[model samples]
Target: MHGPASSGWLLVALCAVTGAYCLARMRSGAEGQRSAAGGEALMGFGMAAMAVPAAVFTPPSWAWPVYAAVFGAAGVHALWAARAGAHHLHHLVGAAAMVYMSLVMAGSPAHAHGRGGSGVPLLTGALLLYFAGYVLLTGVRLVPVAAVAGGGGPAGWGDRPELARACRLSMGIAMVAMLLTL
Candidate 1:
């Protein structure tokens, strides 16, 4: 998120809106979807908070650890939940990536805004690859679904699988951007 102020604000808007939609989805979705939506909501909101430009609001030193702890717990939950479906595995990866970024930010607060870091670390590169692949694959998968679902006069908010996939795709793209900043 250590980019131009405009890009940071755009990321904030994108993630906050996604979080709001996920909250609605959690309320209106079926049992299974509700759980997934809740986790995604957490992710969206967390990303929004993290993507805030450091120049605007540098968090206290303690905040990074809190982020790491929260995402670490989420990752654990996602790992446990993955037994039920592959989507949870994606959640696990996202959570782990957040934790990694939080720790990196904490360790080098000077580099929080991309000021003075070495080249992208190995793990960061690996994560970037994973998320890039995820975004591409998810986008390709959503294409056929979007065509079929077109002009349905708008499905109920939580019932639209195409929208859900698109939401995930957006988050995947956002993740790639965030990793680049790290």
Candidate 2:
């Protein structure tokens, strides 16, 4: 994203598309599914917020502290929500990562696309590596190895469990990529 305008725009598209998919799922899903989808949508929204063209404008420094606080609260909520299922716990970790990234950025400018060099904090680097592995594993799982297994028409975004998981992993990748800019 630090390269050309196209790279930034591509990331924006990825975030927007993922957010839209989550919103659509929340709208069409049943009550139980709706809650999880809603959380996913919220995370998608947060990712989109971070993916915006940083060159255009960055939020004020004060905003970053508020962001950190909000994500911190969300992380706690996610932990409580985890009683429903393991996915919620994953959301909890994601929210915590958001809080950490927010606090890190808050200490600096609201928008800094500084990548490279040894300044990468240990925690941030570890998180980045973890998400990178997740994205890779998810992508591998999505490979088309079941052409004749389903034996049906194309499925909706939410119809396939693997697809949903892939979406979540992609969002994680997006979040980590965005954090690398801080």
Candidate 3:
């Protein structure tokens, strides 16, 4: 049973690590391949962290700034790396969802406990569905290519397959978690 304060710290740590990883990977090469993959993984982890606490425990007032900065950065990065694939859209949507939730949490007076409202759940559910569907679609597309090749295919999946898989699985888990909360 993670309390709101503890959850907020968890989110902060997740975002910080992810942000650092993204920056490091971004500077690694000029092609932006590794950086894009790192960004995708980091975004997945960040989304999972944010979704868990946002769905389980209402965040504190002070946490909103962190959430905003992290998610806003992610959104910008996703848009910047839009050529990666459809997964970029997932990042974009996830970032938008986080920003919206952070704003809502920041404005709410009842930040100590959960917001006992139907609207939050509804919005969360929608965001979860969007990300989950995006993940599933991307996964489905990649699995076949992997299968047809009998191993790592010649497509984009062969290049950074693990990161692609992670993006799909993380988003799927996040979606399930969010739906369970609802």
Candidate 4:
């Protein structure tokens, strides 16, 4: 099978870094910290798992259905979380996109199913558009906050919130790249 090239490795690296940050954030001792850190870490790890194999190697035949089940579960959880706040809806969008890709790809001939893409133009285009808009809007939202954080925005073992946001943004960028590859 054809392996991913340099750009794919770079995207994988971003995912690793994001996952590391989320793990690091789990060390904080503040109130509600465990729950928040756990949730974010799950997201980070999930993104890495999905993105890395997608970027570097062909998925196994079972991957599409697995992805569908996993993301559909995540979507259900996100919907439940949305009852508390609207921000959770963004998770819903991401989960929905993943589940959609997985289901569509599941129907492709077995030989082509492992290539990390659904091969449905409409789905791919819609995902590209959604992620592009997400990345842009997120970047826009971060500008002022990043500016205020000052001096590289609290690097190293602190500023958990900012680091979390950065990890998420990285995942977003990585996902966009992954989709483009497909």
Candidate number achieving the greatest lDDT relative to the actual structure: 1
Q: How accurate is candidate 3 locally (lDDT)?
A: 0.56
State the TM-score for model 2. 0.79
Quote each prediction's TM-score.
0.91, 0.79, 0.57, 0.73
Instruction: Tell me the lDDT of model 4 at 22.
Output: 70
Model 1 misplacement above 4 A: 111-118, 146-154
lDDT of 1 by residue, 46-145 (tens): 9999999887988889999999999999999999999999989999999999999999888775445443657877899999999999999999999889
Q: Which candidate's TM-score is highest?
A: 1
Assess the local accuracy of residue 18 in candidate 2 as a C-alpha lDDT between 0 and 100: 80
| Better by TM-score, candidate 2 or 1 | 1
Candidate 2 wrong stretches, greater than 4 Å: 1-5, 29-32, 110-117, 144-158
TM-score of 4: 0.73
Ranking by TM-score: 1, 2, 4, 3
Model 1: pairs clashing at backbone N, Cα or C within 3 Å: none
Give the poorly placed runs of model 4, Cα more than 4 Å off.
Answer: 1-3, 29-39, 53-56, 108-120, 146-158
How many clashes in each structure? 0, 0, 0, 0
- Using TM-score as the measure, name the better of candidate 3 and candidate 4: 4
Clashing pairs in 4: none
